[model samples]
Target: MAKAAVLVASFLFVALTMFCEEATADYEGCCVSYSKYQLPFIRIKGYSIQTPNDYCDIPAVVFHTIKGRHICANPKDTWVEIRIQQLMNKVKKMA
Candidate 1:
């Protein structure tokens, strides 16, 4: 009887842990630092702005390259600002 109870408890614990992990699977990826070098406009496919939040504390711009790589950049950088503007303009035109 005791052995059966222990077995059930172990199963429940493992199941609950797996369920919790799946729940947070959609968690956003964050950048710890920014890239120093600038990439050309033609190479960038898209970008996302990162701001201080409960999970992410650093402010950055994550630039998505055509080659399926993410490049973290300082939002204050001149080239990054220009790239952001370009992306915004493209979206506006699409609407």
Candidate 2:
């Protein structure tokens, strides 16, 4: 009986550990997709490209707007890529 209880406890510990690890995985908080129409209203404050890691499957570009909005855009989109490059250039010049 004692051996069976120990085995069950060990199994439960392993299962809980795995569950916690998955639950605690990092995720991008700004996962909203933005439309081109909204771009005109938003002033780009900064941007960052999130490369795929263990937690995320695809890459994403996060835009920080002056109006305090963090927008996540699909990096695969041609327009998003171009806009990111342009914003980066503008930031570089400002620095």
Best-fitting candidate, scored by TM-score? 1
Question: In the order shown, what is each candidate's alpha-carbon RMSD?
Answer: 11.2, 12.5
Model 2 agreement with the true structure over 1-95: per-residue lDDT tens digits: 99999999999999997764311113444343333333432477777776665666556677778876666667777867777778778878989
How many clashes (backbone N, Cα, C below 3 Å) per candidate? 0, 0
Distance from true position, residue 70, model 1, in Å? 0.8
Query: lDDT scores for all predictions?
Result: 0.77, 0.63
Query: Which ranges of candidate 1 are over 4 A from the true structure?
Result: 1-28, 92-95
lDDT of 1 at 2: 100
The top-ranked prediction according to lDDT is: 1
RMSD of 1: 11.2
